[model samples]
Target: MNDLTKIMVSKGGTPADITVGDALEYRAALQEHHAQSAGHTLFYAWLRRLGSLPDDAPATLRNPSRATGQVGIEQLVDRCDLTCRPVRDLMVDYLTERRPGLDYPNAGQRPRSLS
Candidate 1:
């Protein structure tokens, strides 16, 4: 298939308005990052780092709209697919298990207490 189609598929069918060359570069970067990632913590860290970049960051860092939470959503979707788990379920489980002190409104809801 075409490069555009390949990129779209690799990103879990998310639409990316990028040239074929850029798509290839992005694919390589994603593959490299995924390969190097130790686990979910590293993945979350990378997404947070991406989200914290200044608005005027370069194309590579700015292409994903992190300031508006788009990057986080994308990362969640990607992670869910990678782990073969439901997004809400995984997040709820993570928060409940990882941060036991937080107050979760419901068993399936996210933690509401953050200090």
Candidate 2:
């Protein structure tokens, strides 16, 4: 909300004055500055509910990079730089088998542990 407030103030308006363009610009700024997904925020929904934004406005102000493909098990294993081909292949197979049971955070941690 602070970010929105700043934008609104800079534009010489209130929250009710925020537009879809403003929200999109904010999302882009977040992605460019933070170098990661902006995820979802309630401001868009709030603006829509207040009739400040169109009902057809997006539910999220997330970055398009949020839809990027997940890194593959092979890619994750390769980053570990295992010198032995057998060990590298085995680690990949292990991760592949375990991936179904693991959530994203746990799956991400597995590669770091390998290093």
Candidate 3:
């Protein structure tokens, strides 16, 4: 299989704190998490060699007050880049899953392509 597919399959499930921290920091955390959690034994071993996540890593860091809404945007764009899912669809799916009872305030407007 391809590298992206391998990575996707390895990720298994999304972490609860995936949406935490600054956009760039969150992405870094995700990369670290994915590398560590990969299902492939070799991939997991490789990550282990890279060392464990820092105690202060942003993934589990609690700083919601600093959230700029850019975290989700960056994740969506990255997922779309990997999976080739349309940005609008991924945005809808993310909102639906992350905040099930609430609707996105900007839902009335069409989403822009991440291309």
Candidate 4:
């Protein structure tokens, strides 16, 4: 990835008040929770990552806040230049959000796409 994206990805760790494991676990929960739903999870995550989210983005892209997406977007933007994380990571996040019959907590609305 480009230097800018590296900077972005580096910022996604847990807050000073939280541990790394805690932050990862929380992100895992969000990914899994959203996965329970059918359709559009990946797309929503991508929109969140791109900062072009719709008003409903929070619910759909729960757990990781805009901060997460900002970091991800930075990574992606850098990646877009140097291919840091594969475009597939975005697709992966979207696909991982499939929980099928599981009930998802309110993550807020899904953000719309920039493209």
lDDT of each: 0.45, 0.69, 0.42, 0.43
Best-matching candidate per TM-score: 2
- Which ranges in model 1 have alpha carbons more than 4 Å from their true place? 1-55, 60-62, 66-70, 86-88, 91-115
Largest lDDT belongs to which candidate?
A: 2
lDDT at 85, model 3: 55
Provide the lowest-lDDT 10-residue window in model 2: 106-115
| Each prediction's TM-score versus the true structure | 0.19, 0.46, 0.17, 0.18
What is the alpha-carbon lDDT of model 3 when measured against the actual structure? Answer: 0.42
Clashing pairs in 2: none
Model 4 C-alpha lDDT per residue in residues 38-76, reported as the tens digit of each score? 332454444345555444435453454553343543444
Name the better of 1 and 2 by TM-score: 2
Query: Which is the better candidate, 1 or 2, if ranked by lDDT?
Result: 2
Compute the lDDT of residue 33 as modeled in candidate 4.
Answer: 83
Q: Summarize candidate 3's per-residue lDDT along 1-115 as a digit string, tens digits.
A: 2332444444533222122222234335556887532332333223333444333333322343343334554554565555555756667677656553343436677654434
- lDDT leaderboard ranking: 2, 1, 4, 3
Residue-level lDDT for 100 in candidate 3: 34
As a whole number from 0 to 100, the lDDT of residue 61 in candidate 3 is 25
Better of 3 and 4 by lDDT: 4
Q: Point out the worst 10-residue segment of candidate 3 by lDDT.
A: 14-23
Q: Which stretches of candidate 4 lie over 4 Å from their true place?
A: 1-15, 35-115
